[model samples]
Target chain A: MTDQATADLWPGERTEAARRLLLAAVESFARRGYHATTTRDIATGAGMSPAALYIHYPSKAALLSEISRTGHRATLDLVEGAEAASGEPVEQMRRLVEEFTAWHARGHTVGRIVNNELHALPEDAFAEVAELRIRIEDTVRRIIEKGVARGEFEVPDSRTAARAVTSLGIDVARWYTDRSTESPEELGRRYGVLVLRMLGSAAA
Target chain B: MTDQATADLWPGERTEAARRLLLAAVESFARRGYHATTTRDIATGAGMSPAALYIHYPSKAALLSEISRTGHRATLDLVEGAEAASGEPVEQMRRLVEEFTAWHARGHTVGRIVNNELHALPEDAFAEVAELRIRIEDTVRRIIEKGVARGEFEVPDSRTAARAVTSLGIDVARWYTDRSTESPEELGRRYGVLVLRMLGSAAA
Candidate 1:
């Protein structure tokens, strides 16, 4: 229940019941979307009555907001961790794309909800989620800026390049499936090079 | 009440009432998403009673299906039209990216519903919409294949490269705003160059 990978993917602690609820919410939200998914649906999916959901979460919006905040923080942490892992900008970009793309492909259920369902969150929740998003953007931008500063990468605009690179992974959640011909690791490898090339990396 | 651009953006001829309902549906779906938006909301948005909506479209799902089909067809036409406008593979890629990106930015409301709200579509309706999506993929893949053949582009995998290039524009619908400093044309121009860079075009 507490594997290293699962522990790393989700940022905060949760009880077994709370974990079940969040997992149910991810499936329902990814399947039916935030606006359409009800707490009853999430509760039933988790094998509990509708009333049981409110004991752990205030509303359906609370469930979605928690998921959004957790996913965003995890994403930001992945990239920021990559930035500190090495001083080489090229390696940093490669690891960043690989981990990010794989996360989106393998955890598409969470990825889909995190990226596509933002508008459904309440205003305050959205702001909290958005702050993490901006930090993710800034972290990617800093990686590009570092490469540019070292004359290692050639991008027209670091900010736009960062956006495109981020979009590359986010869109993977939209199309990737269990039956996809390319495995998550394979996609991560291909995208790693493709993104480096987009950065105008001569090495790519 | 129909403008030339609106007529061009939406395929087929629609009655004024039908057009009103569709336009209203786009606004509602783009704002609240399909599952959250009711037929009454669409009807009210169009200044018609709920019953009046049924006269034009059979159900809420029907309105969404129409919008999804129209938008997917419109997108396919834009890309195919670009392919025919030039014989040069590089030029073909450039125009394809420019027009496709601009359409997503300028026509984002429709684009958002078409891409994001597919699950709300019934199975048969989703199948029809998906066929157009596959064709859009093929069209982009063909552009890359032609460029690779003509020595105008360098890509590791044409299919994956097509997905990335297409994703570059599709994600624009998710983030573009009236407050965005870059206009549709500007985003299109920047994206065209970035896509060319992904293709490894010497010019880029």
Candidate 2:
């Protein structure tokens, strides 16, 4: 579970058994929240005992921190992934929103835990997560900047527009799912319209 | 306080004192969040013993419900106040964003508690707050609709843009004031520009 490669992303053992344990932590954290969940519960959710679970991850907080770190990294990566696309700023934003919204819907627990118990982390840990978040924000701002230079979009302040786009996607963690009134694909399509128009995109 | 008169937004008296008590609840809930805060801390923060606090508001959950209700009502009132002004949709949007941003910045704990612990409310209480929120959202949507009808703005979906505006303002609560880097008015003005642009206002 602690493999730094995926350890930072939260898949245990690379083996099936530890992967089950890691997945269990997601369910436990989602339902009970980070502060309320326990190693024992995660173990039981994986059909094991607390002591056995400890062999995979040192403690409950450790498991949470790893999962949260992984989730945050994934979000940053998703936005960065959009940079490879060659298109107008509006098209880039549409792609970013698609990846951003879908990840939160699929990786529900990690996103929820990171957002909810951010205060639980030690100051240094909090700074790490905060830095990761800022990088993502800056990336969005750069995209807006690129769009402005291309005359593909216009914003009063690229920074504030970036924040709006980021918040629009992040808020999905608070409300999104298959059972939700709006499906992930539908949300992506609608958000594409919303975000594109926010940048003065007539075609979007 | 407890005064519901539209003219007397902030009552002064024991009932007005209830507003203070409720504000205390907002601070407690925002700091520790809804699931983590105890009613005792709320009472003590209000300068009353926990037992005395209970006499005014039955439980932590009840306190959360009241603050959320009041917060939503205050938001609706602000929008209504701006709607009464005779102006183009762009002007109306600017004023609404200015006031809404100030309100969110002024009472961040109220915003945080409302957005974060919304699920903690009892069914009936949740329904009440939810209805109030929907009403506020609908009010914003109406402005968008009117603007679209007047050909003053063009949005793919008025409802989606309304949701974007709310999300943008509410985010002020999550990360506002915590950083001493920007004044409330400055943040409000910057966000106002962003929101107006998001609403498809060329003036933004």
Candidate 3:
């Protein structure tokens, strides 16, 4: 992976060793799930000793919390950044869905870990992740609400619409495979059009 | 919790003891995930010895394969039954989405186990489960195709639209909570309408 992709996958982990451990944890967790993966497995995947793993992360759950928090924060940033781009609601929604879908597809391992491994998080960590999730949903809802207000979209319920939009993007992580014909960008474009149709947008 | 619900969750597991074991496996796998869950945990959940659990399920993977197979079959039966119902394309699509979404919500635990834990299944088991999933997707696709043929819907790509419909429903298993305001049926109804809108139906 490129440095930029690495940073995108696990943002703000500046230390190379720490980032390597985090990446290893993501792969192990994605393949075997959080509860099934051991510190030894993670350490081995990162080419480090178990003690070295602890030097970076205090416990397995700590590693999970860090990954969950960083992944959620990255996605939240992506959505907010997409929304901040100046455009009509339709264009903004299109861009938001496209970018969000591509990100999930491209970083599916981290996406799956962040999404499917939430149950393994410590209570406080789970709550922190939940807060990021709500903010992300609200950002999508806000965009849909704006579209409805401007008469560009016909949505019965912005909250439900937001959930559907996010669901469409999030589900990509669960199903996307390397053998799949569509690239992340291609899938994003298709979803962008499909989501527009879903919202009853004239632009669809 | 009802007998009917039990049968629906794990169809064809006739013996009461086996059904109990299956139910126990579902709970353990859903809570801790497949790889994390031991057969001993499943047996304990079912109030039996590990030896007795083995008599019914050869291994933990066997239990998961059964759950995965049964869940996929149940959903495939649901989509096909929905299609076999007498209705216009719009109503058929509505019923299909409604029932599929409600099934996932009501049986969220089994749904999660089936959809999320496929990797834990043995190779042949995974392929078997994949076949059932494809049938389910194809059933939805055929319904959408019929709607387009009958001039009842305006979907650009039936395959992608079918995927979106199933994705919307499958995701409910991941996110639905008892604390949520909407009941399974209510969420299903909401999704039914949203799907129609997604297809660009006049009824939407």
Candidate 4:
């Protein structure tokens, strides 16, 4: 909407330059927030002209689209890859919670932007992001279903339980920070215990 | 910073007008998010001039600060009022979960905005808001500790159990909507059952 939208600012940059631009945008977006972060701010943060941002992406929306897409993909891979953790369904669930929560706590910018600002994305992009989320959610549902069948867990409404687990992990993106006393590993382990109890299983 | 810094905005003429402005701000902040929402957007949504909005509030920050303070106060009141809902500690805990979840579902805009944007406020405002939150959290913690002491329930750690209970209820604001098949009351009751089970008690 502004003159020469951020999308058109840069074409392609040096690999390091693009990486810096991405990191700068991440910090700015996390610090001030998405809609408030201008291409100029991100470009300046990367020590480039606003016009240079276009070398890597087409628009500010493009920047957000990429971050969200990438973050969701990473999250989905963790859940789907839980299937490959080489453990019982319950242990797989534990590993899933640990990996998921830690990623969110460390990947604050991208994860929070993805989870909190879904309503901000343009239509086609939102659909892509939502589909990725559904896959991750379905992963939780399947894990719970398997646990129930194996008699490792007892719970009512696996779908709701799945929702609870996913929601708990997602909220870490909203609130958890390194400034807190609890380390990511410790916090995730504690959350895993509560999550397992919620599912009516043995201690995590 | 704007000339609209008058006390008239607090709660004067045409109470519905102020109410409408407040509600519209909530929607704008939730839909577009706190950082993205501007006075112009909110004023436009309420069919008022930007100057008219000033007559109602000093600045955009004031609007958000007021909303957050009121929302936190409302939450504190809810928790304190629900402290003695039934004869038994377990029943009281169930009522707390049911009420809190239902409150989050019904008041998603306020809860979401307060939870997500509290950091945007200045230090004094932030401290005030944090105090209210700690109070509510302690109330939940005390309730669980008391329940354990009374032998109505058992928990691994009363503090951890409190966090799980609050997190489950708080998550309702992020996910539960009227669009879902389960009504707020239904979700509240179902979540209450899980909370009881996690506390080592039978479902109420």
Task: Point to the candidate with the largest lDDT.
Answer: 3
Q: Give the per-residue lDDT of model 2 (tens digit) for B21-61.
A: 77677666666666657878888878888878867887887
Q: Which digits, one per residue and each the tens of the lDDT, describe model 1 over residues B1-204?
A: 222333465445788899889888887887787888999999999999999999999999998888888888888999999999999888988999999998888876677778888878988899999999999989899989998998888888998899988988998877776667777887888888888887888877
* Residue pairs with backbone overlap in model 2: A1-A13
Model 2, residue B73: distance off in Å is: 1.2
Candidate number with the higher TM-score (3 or 4): 3
Error of 2 at A107 (Å): 3.8
Q: Better model by TM-score, 1 or 3? A: 3
Which candidate gets the maximum DockQ versus the true structure?
Answer: 3
Per-residue C-alpha lDDT of model 4 across residues B1-204, encoded as one tens digit per residue: 101211223355447767667767877887777788999988987789999999987777777888788778877877877786666677778888888888887777677788889888877779999999889889888888888888877776777678778877887777765578777788888888778877877553
> lDDT (CA) for every model shown?
0.84, 0.73, 0.85, 0.76
Give the alpha carbon lDDT tens digit for every residue of A1-204 in model 3: 322343566556458899889888877887778898999999999999999998989998998999888889889998999888966788889999999998888877778778888878999999999999999999999889888988888877788789989998998889877667788898888889889988888788
Enumerate the chain B TM-scores of all models. Answer: 0.94, 0.86, 0.93, 0.88
Better of 2 and 3 by lDDT: 3
Instruction: Give each prediction's root-mean-square deviation over alpha carbons.
Output: 2.7, 4.6, 2.2, 6.2
Model 2 lDDT, residue A78, Cα: 83
Name model 2 segments beyond 4 Å from true.
A1-18, A106-109, B1-21
> In candidate 3, what are the lDDT values of residues B150-185, reduced to their tens digit?
888887678878888999899988887656778888
lDDT per residue as tens, model 2, A1-204: 221222345444366657767778877776765666778889998999888888878887776666667678888888888866856667778899887876665554466667777887766667888899999998888888998898888877787778778877777767554466766667677777778777766666
